[model samples]
Target: MRLAIGLAAAAWAVIGSAASAQDYRPTFHPDQLKGPPAGAFNEVLVLGSPHLSDLPDSFRAEQLQPLLTRLEAWRPTAVAVENLSGLQCDFMRRYPSRYAESVEAFCYDPSAAGRALGMDVPTANAEVERLLEAWPKAPTAADRRRLAALFLAAGEPGSASVQWLRLPAAERVAGDSLTAEMAAALDRRMTRKNEVDLVAAVLAARLGHERLWAVDDHTADSATPPDEEEAQAKAIMAAWDNPYVQARKDADQRLYADLEHPDGVLNIYRDYNTPDTQMVVYRSDFGATHVEPSPQAFGRRYLGYWETRNLRMVANMRDVLGRYPGTRMLTIVGASHKGYYEAYLNQMHDVRLVSSDEVLR
Candidate 1:
C-alpha cells in the first residue's frame, strides 16, 4: 500500500513540477491581500444543512431549537440562504427555454399580488428596498404584512417568510395588499420546513432582521437537450454508483431514522459539517465524477455546472457582505455545498471563514 501511495505521490509531483514550469501560472492570491487595519474582519459562518423538506416525517419544528440556539449565539448580522433571487427568476422568465424548469422549481410567481398591487418582480423588489430603508424601529403587524406582500410580488417568499414569521399568528392573515391567496401561500411557506423558511427566515426574524437574502443562483443551469438528456443522466448516475456514495446513503438513512431525538437535527448537521464528511462528499460526488470515462464528457459538464453554481452563490453572498461590510454573515446551504462554499469564500480578501465545528459545538 505504501509503494502504491509513493508511486501516486511521485506522479503528482512530476505533474505539479511541469505545471509550475509554465510562466502563465498566476502568482498572486486574493486571500493574501486584506483588511482595513481598524475595522473588524467580515466573519462568515457557512452552515451545511439538510433540505428540511426531505427530513423524516417524524421530524418536528422543536427539533430545531438547539441548532437555532447555537446559531443565534453566533448572532449573524446578515443571513443568506440557498434560494434564487426573485429578480433572477424574473429575468429567467424572459428566456423560458433555458430556465423554465429552474424557475418553476425554485422561483415563486407573485403574479396575484403583482397584479393586485401593480407590482412586478422588479417593481416590487424596488418597493421592498424602499420600505426597508425607511423601516421603523418598531414596525406594526400592518407594517410586516405590507412588507410581506411586497416580498411576494418580488418573487421572494423566503424574504416574505421573514416578515410572515415575525407577525403574530393573529396578524398573519390577509391585509395591506397581501391578498388572501398570497397570505395563504405565506402561511404554507412558514410551515414548509425548508431550510430557508424553518431555519434562515426564522433566525433572521428572531434577530430582528427586516429581511433575509436569497443568494442561490441557477443562471448557469441550461436545459439538457432532449436527445442528450438520457446520456447525461446515465453518465452521472454511473459515477454516483460508487462505494463512497453507498456509504453516504447508508449513513443518511440512519441519521434520518433517528430524528426522534432532541439533538437529531444537530447531529445530522454535525455529520454534514465534519472534516471527514468533506472528503467523503468530494470522493462520493465531484471527485468520483471527475474521473468518469464518458465519451461525451458529461461528467465534466456536470462538474462545471456544479462549480459554476456554487461560485455564483458565493458571489451573491460576497455582494451582500460588500454592501454591509465588517458584519458577520450566516449562509445556510446544502450539505454537499459546504466544502465548495468554504473553498471559494476562503479566497476573498476581506472575509474571515468561521469553522462550522466551532459554531456547531
Candidate 2:
C-alpha cells in the first residue's frame, strides 16, 4: 500500500510540472494570424489634424464609427496607445498643473492645431472629451485627479481643467506656471511631434482592445539643424526661379487664392504648416525624405523622423504579432504617416493595409 501511494504522488508531480510549463506558453492560434481580407487591410490610420477644426463634422458618424464597427467585426485581440508611463498617469492625477501643461502642449502644439482644423473643430480636446464623455464608464475621480496633477505639472491648462477644478485656485495657478515651463522645455525637444502620433495611436488602439502595445521610443532631443544640409537646401531654394515655384510663392502671400475660398485656404495652409513629423515621401530609389515640414521649416522638408520610427514601430508590431500569433492590429497615426506605413506594412507577410476612404466608405 505504501509503494502504491508513493508512485501516485510522483505521477501527480509530473502532471503538475507539465501543466505549469504549458501555461507559460502563449496559446495564440495560427489560423487567426491572418491579416485583413484581400482588398481590405488591417489599418494604421494616420491623421495630420492638430486641432478640432481639422476633422470633418462627419468624422464621428462617418470615419470613426465605421472604423469602430469594422474593428468590432474583425475582433482584434490587442490595441495600443501612446500613453504616459503608469507612474506618469498617476503623477498627472495627483498634480494638476503638470497635467495641464502637458495637455496644453499636446493640444496647442502646431500639429494639434492642424489636426483640430482638419476635423473642422476648434481643438482636439473636444474630440477627446467627447470620447471620454460618451463612454458610459470612464476613469474614476481618483484617476482624473491623478491625470490632472500630471497636466498641471506638464503646463497644459486645458488639460488641467479636466481635473484641476477640484483643487484650490492658488495651487492651480502655481501648478500652471510650472507646467508651462515644463511644456516649453518639451517643445524644444524633437520628440514632441512623434510623441503625439504615438499617443493618439495608442489611445485609439486601447479603446479597441485589452492588450495594448506601445511601439514608440520616448527619448527627447533638441532640434538642431544639420548645418551642411541646411546650407545646401538654402542654396537650392535660392537658385529656384521656376514659374511653378514662383506661382506657389506668390500664392503663399495671399491669404486666399483665386481658385480657393478663404476657409479652404486656411485649412490647407494650416495642414501644410503642421505636417506630421514621421511623414515620408519615397524617391525613385525608395530613399525617403520628410514629406511634411514643421511651421519653422516653411514646408521645405517633406520627410523627417518617421522612417526611423516606423521601422522600429513595425518591428514592434511584428513582435506583438509573433507573441499573439494570430491577433489583428489596428494602428493609428498621423495622416502623412498613413501612406508610407501602409505601403511598407503591406509588404510584410500576412499583413494588410486599409485606407481611410475605404474604411469610411
Clashing residue pairs in all predictions, respectively, total 0, 83
lDDT of 2 by residue, 1-361 (tens): 9999999999999999999998886676543565554444433433322222343332221223323454455444555433332323333434544355443333333233223234322233344345445543445444444444343333232333424333333343323223444334432331223323323333333343212344432222113346556754554454342354444345434433321342442343234323232232222112322222234542233224445556655666666665555555655443344455555565566565444443333
Residues forming the 10-long window of minimal summed lDDT in candidate 2? 280-289
Q: Candidate 2's error at 202, in angstroms?
A: 11
- Across 137-244, the per-residue lDDT of candidate 1 in tens digits comes to 989999999998888889888888899988988999998888889888888887887888888999999998888888999999899999999988999999999999
lDDT of 2 at 112: 32
Q: Candidate 2's error at 341, in angstroms?
A: 1.0
